[model samples]
Every structure is written in structure tokens, then in C-alpha cells.
Target: MTTVPPFQRALEAHGDAVWRYLRGMVGAGAADDCFQETFLAALRAYPRLHRESNLRAWLLTIAHRKAIDHLRRRRRDALEPLGEEIEAKPQGDGAIWSAVATLPPRQRAAVLLRYGGDLAHREIAAAIGCSEEAARRSLHEGLKRLRETL
Candidate 1:
């Protein structure tokens, strides 16, 4: 069997996760652009990737950074107010997704990474470019805020 390049293998493995992360970051509307940008950036940086043990985490880290960058740039340009509320049920109770969605970007990212993506604290920290402690704090604060809304 022909061997797949590391970069290609990484893309195949993590593409959906990265896209999901981007969707949570930028909403579904702009997710495609952010996804493209993320992989493009990854393709450029793939040669410098020295670790093969945790390619999923590495690719997620890049995607997270790209999503943040995209959000920053979008904020600078014409920005639209967040539209509509998303309703979610936690522990079988209905809650407004808008309430949780109101969290600051980093906290939202942390929460989404944890609950939505089923990632561990370390993985969330890697994706958000923060310390594991910071990621934990964000998740804690997000859950606290969400509870208040509930």
C-alpha cells in the first residue's frame, strides 16, 4: 500500500473536528471560509510540524488560532449583532443557547470544546492557545454563567 503523507493523513483525520470548531467559533454562515483558511494555514505550516504523536491536537490548535484571527478581523470590519437564540437542553432541561452564547469568545470556545467536542481540558487549552488552568477557568466561568441564565 502507498503511504499517505503526514499532512494528508492529519487533514483526513481532523478535518471534521476542525470544521466543527470553526462553526462554533464563527457560526455556521462563515464557517466555510474559516475552515478553508485553517487548512490553508495548516498546509503552509505542515512542514514544520515535528511531532506525530498528537496530530489531531496539533491541527485543532491551528484551526483555533485561525478562527480567532478571523473573528478579530471580522470584528474590525462591519460586524453584525448576534442573531436569534439557540435553545439547548443540559441534563434534560431546556435552556437558551443564546444565554450561553453570550459568553466572551474564549469562554465560548472553551465550553464548546468541552461539551460539544468532548475534548479534555488539555485539548481545549491547546486549541485555545491558553494554559490548561486558563481553559479550566474559562469552562468554569462559562458553566457558572450558563447556570445563572438557567
Candidate 2:
């Protein structure tokens, strides 16, 4: 067995990162609810989880699905600007991140998983339920678009 951390410890370890990921996806206004939903769902399903599971990736996978569901329910943009409204300036932080919001859904998820979730390509593939090549393509194209927008 890979000796995953207990759920409480996993929450303590991953809570902040998961919240930030949610915030990056849905904006801070709804992030708290989404965060709770993620954990609630995770807790309900935790017992049946495989012992060899990658907990953080699994949690993030749940977060990704929850975010997508949240987006579909609300029909909102996948990502909001990071801090404040970004004027269309090339060098602004908000502008850069805001660009991320403009990507198509798959690309946006790929970008957020790579940068926001700090996940590797393989992990991102696993989390997003895509093949590694598709994940790589999304990440690559997403970054290219962000750069162009910035």
C-alpha cells in the first residue's frame, strides 16, 4: 500500500490548495460552497476508495467535476480574474489570468489543473479523465492562448 494520509490529515494538507483551485475556477463568492460540496462528496465516497489512490489528485478530480457541474448549473465563465477587474493591459496580472478564463472549457480546465492545482501532466490527465496526450495538448494550447492574450 502507498500509505495515503488519513482523510482528516488530507483535508488539512489539501484544504487550502483545493479552496484556491475552487476560487480560481468559480470566483471567491461561490468557492466556499463548492469547497464544502467537494469535501462532502469526497467524505461520502472515501470509504470505498482504493488504498493505493493518490489522494490529492483524487480530491482535485472531484473538485474538477464539481466545478464543471457548478459551471453548468450557473452557466458562468469557468474562471474569473484573479484579484480585480483587469483592464486590457498586456502586463497586468488580472489580464493574464483573465485570459485563462477565455479559453474553451477543456483548455481552461487543463490550464487550471497545471497552474492552479500544481498537478503534473499525468496527474492532470487522471484528474480530468483525459488521456495524457490530450491533456498535454490542452495545456500546451491553453498556455499559447494565454500568452497571446497577455
Candidate 3:
């Protein structure tokens, strides 16, 4: 059997979180494709990884960028309309998935990372390629928008 590299191990370990993050970014249908692309990109760039510390954050960062690129490539002018079944379920604040779909990309990502993947501000910053303060601001702004919508 081939020995798994540390990076590979880390990728396997955190795959679910990365998938969840992508799902929130692109929705459930595209999540797996984005996840595969994220890991493939990671493998191509694996030689450059300098440290094991915060591997989850590192993987998430790659996943975030890949998700963004995937979205860009699709050239979607607006958020996809939510299906009726998904739209009917009430979110925590009695909002629906359609409301969540209306957020801007950055705020949506922050909200997804915070609530969907349960990442801290620091980790979210690493993933979103922003400062911790910025991550916090994004999350706060997202929540505020969600509150207003609901």
C-alpha cells in the first residue's frame, strides 16, 4: 500500500468540512465537483505547503478559492432560485433558504463558514483570505442581513 503523505492525510480528514463549505458556496448540487477540484488543486500545489499547523484552515482556503473560481466560470448573473422543497423549510430565525440565497458572495461565505462549518473568525479569515477582523465583520454583516430578511 502507498503511504499517504501528511497533506493527503489532512485532506482526507477535513474533506467533509471542505465539502460543507463548498455546498454553502455553490449549493449541494455543485459541492462535490468543487470539492474534487479543490483537492486536485491542492495536490498540484502540495509541494509548497510549509507547515502542518492549521491544516484544516489551509484546506478550507483552497476550497474557498476553488469554489469562487467555479462560480466565476459558470458566469451566473444572480443567485440560483431555491427549489420549493428547500424553500419551505424554516431556518432558525423563520427565514427560508431563499433568503440565505440572496446574500452577497462574501457575506454568504462568511455565514456558511461560521454556521455551516462551525469555523472561528481566525479560521474563516484563513479560508476567505482576509484578516480575522474582516472575517468577523463579514459574519456580523451577514447575520445582520439575515436578521433583516427574516
Candidate 4:
């Protein structure tokens, strides 16, 4: 069997999507911190990861945890997330993203995973620690809310 590279290689390969997912999760300002924590946590747990594990889903799962931690810390500070959200947009997608950013956290994560990270519902379910049906429902609700808002 061919051997795969380790966490460093995985980080280089999937960093952009993970960063974007974290940005969508907690906004740009906090994304870097969460991104770093995700890899750090992943580093600690890397040795235990199975060879067949989906690295993208695994990284996103770690990112999700880091995001939750960041949100909790932000809550302790009494700060709003989207209040200081992404200062940059992907050109012509600003309105759509604004609507997306207003979505409830679970819905937002669902949307981001489905579209931003290009993850299947099953992978998203794994990343978010939910049932596949729940991931689908969250995506549906998030899209409905986005349509309504936009």
C-alpha cells in the first residue's frame, strides 16, 4: 500500500478550505486563531488517526471544535461575531454572504460546509457531530433563510 504524508502535508493541502470554513464559522478576525488551534489540536491527535480517515473531514471537525471554543470565549467577552465579520468578500458575492452570515450557527455551518468546503452531507455530519439527516435539514433551512433574507 502507498503511504500518505503526515499532518504537515495535510495542513498544506487542506488549509485554505479549513481557514474558509473557520472564517464562515466565526468570521475573519477570529479565524486565524481558530485555524491555528485546529491544527494544534489535530497535531496532538494525529497519531491516533486511522490511515483511511478522511483528512478534510477530520480537519474540519477539529476546526469546528476550535470555533466553538472561540465563540464561547467571545460570549464571555460580550462581543458579537458578525458585528466584526469578514472585511473582505469574494467579489459580487457580498450580499449572499451577508445573508449567510446572519444565519443561526448550525445553519451557517451547514451552508458553509455544503458550499464553501464542498463537503457532502455525510462528511458535514461527521464534522459537525450530527446525523446526516440533520445536516441535510440544516442546509435546507439555511438556504431557505438565505432566500428569505436576500
lDDT of each: 0.72, 0.79, 0.75, 0.83
Cα RMSD to the true fold for all candidates? 4.3, 4.2, 4.1, 2.2
Location of the lowest summed lDDT over 10 successive residues in candidate 3: 78-87
Using lDDT as the yardstick, the better of models 3 and 4 is 4
- Give the per-residue lDDT digits (tens) of candidate 2, residues 24-131: 676666778899999999998987888887788888999999988987876655454433422332443666556665777788888888887889999999988989
Winning candidate number (lDDT)? 4
Poorly placed runs, candidate 3 (over 4 Å): 1-8, 76-97
lDDT of 3 by residue, 1-150 (tens): 243366668776888788767766776667789888888888877777665456677778888898788778655654455333235545553243556667788888899888767788989988888899999999999889988987
Error of 1 at 72 (Å): 1.4
Cα deviation of 144 in candidate 4 (Å)? 1.5
- Give the candidate number with the greatest TM-score: 4
Model 2 global lDDT (CA atoms, 0 to 1):
0.79
lDDT of 3: 0.75
Per-model TM against the reference: 0.76, 0.80, 0.75, 0.88
lDDT of 1 by residue, 1-150 (tens): 243366778777778887766666666667788888888888887776665446667667777777778778877895764333123213232244555557788888888778756689999988887899999999999888878877
Model 2: lDDT of residue 95: 60
What's the alpha carbon RMSD for model 1?
Answer: 4.3
3 against 4, candidate with superior TM-score: 4
